[model samples]
Target: MANAKLNVLVAEVPEVIPLVQEAWRAHFALTFCTSLAEAETLLNKRFDVIVCGTHFAESKMFDLLRMAKSKPKSQAVPFLCIRVLDGELDGTAFQGISIATCALGAAGFVDLNRWRREYGFDQAREKLRQLVVSLAHQPT
Candidate 1:
């Protein structure tokens, strides 16, 4: 476990891919999924952690999180919700969503915009990386 590479399922929109790549790729092996169907297919495969975005067209983050947590193969995997302030949602909305996701059994939530505004880009990136890494290493 100490030397093993973390496997992350990143369910995000196309726009957020670069952000995930920048902050996550260096720390984990990531699989990107844009829709519920894509995520449904990938859920069968083993993943140490799931980092999901809130921009899917048909399904919400809660839907995706529940789907992953329901699957026998992925039920034990940690799920983290990533919220990007892309005008679709504001800061207050994101705070509510963050609390909601956590209540639904998510391992954590990352508000990229808030972190960047408060801590700056480099620090926010490291903060996210550290949170995900810590969640991935937790006991199942």
Candidate 2:
């Protein structure tokens, strides 16, 4: 039998779905949710990773990270939070949010603008690929 594709839970804004799907759907079995509440409902299910898009300093993405870390089934799953830049914020502000998210249990942070400009996730993609490969090789 063929191996199952890795499952990914994407909790991001609606407008960013196309970009995310183009990058992830081909490799993983993706389930998209536009809101934190919707993501919460699916927490009981299994996912290899959670990719979230941050909106502000205290965005719902952080809450999801905390909740996932607290859950037994999902606690080990990695959460990658992508910081979106609108050209209005400085690097300091973005760093602060990324730090806070990591403190709250996010596995890592990615700069969305950098990923877009690079036409891919760049370093973030490599990290995620490593994570997926590691997860796939683990015995159940």
Instruction: Specify the highest-lDDT model's number.
Output: 1
- Global lDDT of model 2: 0.73
For residues 1-140, write the lDDT of model 1, one tens digit per residue. 67777999988888878877876676789899888888999999999899887776444788988998899999989999877746435678877887898888898777787788889889988888888888887999
lDDT of each: 0.83, 0.73
Superposed Cα deviation of residue 64, candidate 1 (Å): 0.8
Candidate 2 regions off by >4 Å?
1-3, 56-58, 116-140
Ten-residue stretch with the least lDDT total in model 2? 82-91
Question: CA RMSD for every model?
Answer: 2.1, 3.8
Off by over 4 Å in 1: 87-92
Estimate the TM-score for candidate 1. Answer: 0.88
Positional deviation of residue 68's Cα in model 2 after best superposition, in angstroms: 1.3
